[model samples]
Target: MALVGPEEPHYCNHHVVASTGRTRKMTLVRALRPFRVVRRTLAVFTLGAMVIVSFALLPSNVADAATVPVSTQAVVQTAPDLAKICARLKITVARTSLCSHGPDPVDAFGGGARLKQTSAVQEQGVAAAPASELTALCNADGVSGKRIEVIYGVPQDRTNRFSAMVAPLRDMMRQVNNNLEAADAATSQNYRFLCTNGVDVTVRNVTLLPVGSDASFTFDDYVASLQNQIAFGLGPVDFIANERLYIAYIDQVQDSYPFGGQGELSIDDQPSAAANANNDSRPRYSMSAYLDMPVMAHEIGHNIGAVQDSAPHSSKGGHCYDEADLMCYDDGGLYFALGGTLTFTCPGADTAIDCHDEDYYYPGTPPASNYLATHWNTANSGFLTPVVSAATPPTVTGKSPVSQATRVAQTANATATFSEAVQGVSTTTMRIKNPGGTVLSSAVSYNTTTRVATINPSASLAADTKYSVSLTGGVTGIRDLSGSPLVSTGWSFTTGPAPTITTRTPGSGATGASRTASVSVTFSEGMAGVAASTFKLKNTATGAAITALVSRNGTTNQWILNPSATLAATTNFTVTITGGSTAVRDLAGNPVSTSIWRFTTGS
Candidate 1:
C-alpha cells in the first residue's frame, strides 16, 4: 500500500548514475577518513545533562544493569563541558549543528517531522539477553556470526572510569539500537546490533583493549593503536580470523577533535571484491563519539555500509546533502556544499539512513548491475534484518468493512491495523464521514503492543447511509515510530437494512408443496455469501436439517434450495435464513435478521 510520507526526497535520477563505474573506484581504495559529515555533529551530551537523565533511565535493551559483574574503577568526574569538548577538538568554528548543540536539548529529527532522529525509542518487545547470559556464538541475537562489540576503552593517562559508565553505555547503545530498530521498522526489515550478555554490547568476556587512551590522539593513531592492540591480545583465535566491528566508547575529553568517531568503510565501489583481514565485506572497527546516540548510529552506520562515494547525493567525505537525513550534510561536494538550498525535507525519520533509497541504501532488491546492486547494500547487510523486496513506509495493513462493504452496523467500530506501530493518530488523521462528506465525531486510539490503531464514532452510524473512512499520512501526519508516514487511504461502505427473505416458495404452511420440486426464497436485495449455516432445511417433527444443494439466481435475488433426495410426502419442513454478522450477508455486508417459514409437501 502506498504510504504518505514527506515529499519524495528530491534526487536527480539520471545524474552521474552508472550501470557500473567499478573501474574508477577500483584503484582509489581507501579506508574511512576523519572528516566525514556524520562525524561533524558535535553533540557532547554525555558530558552534560543527558548523562544525568539517560544514566538514570534503565536501559530497555538490557534486562538488568546490575546483573553483569563489571570491573571496578575510579568515580567519573563530571562529564566534560561543551567548551572543554570543543576546545579539545580545536574547533574555532562557531557552534550550531553538532559542536555546540550538545547541551542544548533538541528534537532528534533535527529540522523536520518526516523522520525520527536517532534516539532511544522505547521498544516493548522481548528484552535482549544480558551479557552474562549470552550464548556461545556471537549470532545469539541479530545478524548471524557477526557482532558489534562495545567497549569502555579507558585512557591510561585520563582515568579508569569503567565502573560508572557501564549503565550509561548500555543506555546509550540502547538508543542507537532503538533507532536502528526504527529504521528496520520503516523499511519493513528487522536490523539490530548483536546484544550479548554484557552491556547489550559485547565488552566484558570478549578481549577488549587494555591500553588506555592517550592525550592528543588523532584518528589515524586511534585506528592503528586498537588494531595493533587487538591483534596482539586476541592471540590468533578470535583476532586474526575475527570479522567483527569493534565500537570503543571512551570517556576522553573530546576537545580539538575534528570527528566524533572514525570507522573503516568496508563497502567497495568495485563489483569484484578483494579479500581482506576479516574476509567479510563489512567494517571491522569504529571508535569514539558513541556516547551520543546520533553520532554513534552515524559512526556505526559507516561500519555497516552507507553514504558511499558512488551514491548520487554522496559528497567527498562520505555523506549525503539531503538536509534533515541523519547522514545528509554539507560535507563539501553535493548540493549543500555547492551553495544550493536545502528544504530540510528529508523523508521518513530524522535518523532515516538514505533520504532517497536510490542513493546509499536501497530497500528493494536492487536492479541488476546498478550501483546499489553492485556495491554493498545496507538493507542486505549481514548485521541487519533480512530484506524483503522493497521497503515501504508503515501503512494501514487491514481495515474494517473493507472498501465498498455494504450493510455495515451503525455501532461498529472502524478499526485499522498498521504494518508496524505508528504514532500521531487522531480524528484529524483518521475519520468516518457521510456520503455528503460530513465527518462523524470520532475517537482514535493506538495500541503500541498490537500495532493497531482504532477509531470509533461517538454515536452509532446512520442506517441506510453510505459513509467513508479515511486515514491520512505525510510529514506531520500518521507516522510509524520508525519514521514512515502512512500514505493516505480510505474505503467507502454503505450502511443499510440487513437483507431479509421477502418471499418463500409454496407460501408458509401451505397445504401442499411439490415433493419433486425445489424450494426458493427471494431476498429484498442482492445477496453475496449464502451458506448452509444461514440457509437450512429441517423436518419440523425431527428437527434434522435436510441435505441440499443451494444456488443463487442473481437476476431474481433468490436462493434455490434443492434437497439431495426427494422430499417426503405430506411432511412439514422449515426453512430458516439465520442472521447476525457471520450469517447470510448482503453485498453491503448487512446480515439478514433470522427468518423461518414452514411449508407442507404434496402427498
Candidate 2:
C-alpha cells in the first residue's frame, strides 16, 4: 500500500456497479443458463427414477442409492462461468489452485472434491462442491488451514530498544485478526477464515553497512543483506508443509516512502528446500519498524491474493481502487456491518480510512469487490481462524540488595532482574536517588542474556545512608519482550555505619615532639569536611592558641593540620577537637569524637 498519497475519493465498488457491468452481467446470465438447464434435466430425471425405482427396488436399496455420492466434476461442468471465475482469479481448491492443469480435467474437482467428499460421505449423500470454492465464486474467497510465521529482524545497536516495537507490532497483529473476523462476519460467503497459527519473534544482531550520500546501497540491497543475515543467523526454516514464513525487518533506519512493507504473493527461493516445497511455495511479506496497523494489514492482504489485476472483479487500480478498502489508498477502517448499517472505526485513528457513514459498506448491496471480501471468509476455508489465547506479559521477578534491606555495601551496584528477557532498560527508566531526593550520577546497562539491569554510581554511596532505586512504568517506560511496561516501584537500601577516626598524629603525652611538625588524623573510612576550626593547637601553660590550616587527603582519607607558625619553643602544646561545633564529619554525617590530647614541643 502507498504510505503517503493524495486523498482520492473513490465511491465504494458496492455502490457503483463497475463500468463493465453490461459485459459482466451478460457473462453472469450466460453462466447461469447452464445451471438452469441442468436443474430442469435433474428434475425430469428424478421424477422418472422415483417411479421406476419404487416398482423394482426394496426401501433399503432406494435409501442406499439416495446416499450415493455425486461427482464434483458435474457441478463445475454445469457452472462453466463460475469455474472460469475461480481459475481466472487463481482461487485455490483445497490447497491446489483451480488454474493448474494436471490430469484433472474438472477444474474444480481436484482438491475441492476431497474436501467436499469428507463432509458428503459422512452425511450419506452425494458430495457437494466445497462451500469455500462456491463462496469465492459468488463473493469473497479464502483458503483455510494456512499458517504464518512472523519473524522480526533487529540490528545490534537497536537491540536494547527493541521493546519499543514489540507492542506496536503485537497490536498490529491483533488489528489484522480483528479486521479479518469482521470481514468474515459481514460477507455472505462461508469459508475457514485465516488465523494466526503461530507467531515467533527472533532478534538477530546484524552489522549494517553505512549508507553513503550518493545512495551507494539501495533499500533492496539492505533487504537482500538482511535476508542473507537471517539465513546465517537462524539457519534453515523448519516450517510444516502448509506453514508460511514472513520476515519483518525492524531496523533503526527508516525506509523510503510508499513502501512501509512489501511481499510476494508466492516466494519460491526460500532459504530451506522444505519451506520452498511447502504448499505451492508459501508467500513472504516484510516491513520495517516504521509501520502502522493498516500498512501491515495491507501488505499481508497482498500476500493472500487480493485485488489482483488478473481477476475479473479487479480494476485499473489493481489492489488500490476503493478508497475505503483496506487494499485501497485509505486505512480501510475496521468495519463490521449489521442489518443495513455499517459499523466502522479506525484503530487509534492512526489510519487513512475516514470513519464516516458514507465511507463504509452496508449489507444487501453488492458486496465490496475488494480485498475485504476476496480474502475474509470465515467458513471452513476462511483465511483466519479463531485465536486460542491472548499473549502473556513480562514481569519483574527479583532485584539485588533486596528492598528495605540495610547494611548494604557502599560500593555495591543496584540490579533488577525480570521474569523474562527485557529491553529498553536505560538510565532514563531506572535510577538511584539518595534520601535527599537527589538522583545519583550513574551508568546504567542491561544484560539481555541475564535479563538484569545494573546501575553503577559514579562514586561510593554515603555510609549509613538510605538510597531509593526506581524503575519507571508507563507506555514509554521500560518494557519486556511482549512490550508490557514494568510496574513502577521503589526499593531502598541503607549503607553500613559511618567511619570514625582510628588514629591521630603526635601521640598523647609525648615529652619532646618537634615544634615544626604538622598534626594529622586517620579515619576508619572515607571522611569529609576537613577545617581548621575542627582541630586546635595551644600553649598548655600560656593559654596561647595557634592557627592552623586543615585539609583531607581523598586517597588516604586522612586529615592534615598545618600550624600557621612554628609552635612556641619550650612550650607544652595541647590539641583539641571541639565536640559540638566540630566541622569534620564522615561521609555518612557522623561527627568525630570530641577529645583533647597534648604533646610538649622541643625547647
Top model by TM-score, which number? 1
| Per-residue lDDT over 144-175 for candidate 1, one digit per residue giving the tens place of the 0 to 100 score | 46566666665334566566555556545644
So what's the TM-score on candidate 2?
0.29
Residue by residue across 1-603, what tens digits does model 2's lDDT show? Answer: 121122311112111000100111112122332123433442344334223221110111011111111211011011113233333323232222222100101111111222232222222321222221122112212323454444445433233344444433433343343344234122221113232321222223343323333222222323333334333232233212343435354444432211244433321112122222222343333443333344455545544443332222222122322223454331121110111111222221212222221222222232555322332211222233332111233445566886544557889999987667776778877888764456789999998889888999999998777676767644567766667655344455668664566777887888778888888878777654455655777888878778888776658877778898887776778887643211444544344556688887778
Q: Which candidate comes out best when scored by lDDT?
A: 1
Quote the positional error of residue 278 for candidate 2 in Å: 12
**Each model's backbone clash number:** 27, 21
Q: How close is candidate 1 to the true structure, as a TM-score?
A: 0.41
C-alpha displacement of 438 in model 2, angstroms? Answer: 28
Give the range of the ten consecutive residues with the poorest summed lDDT in model 1: 14-23
Error of 1 at 294 (Å): 1.1
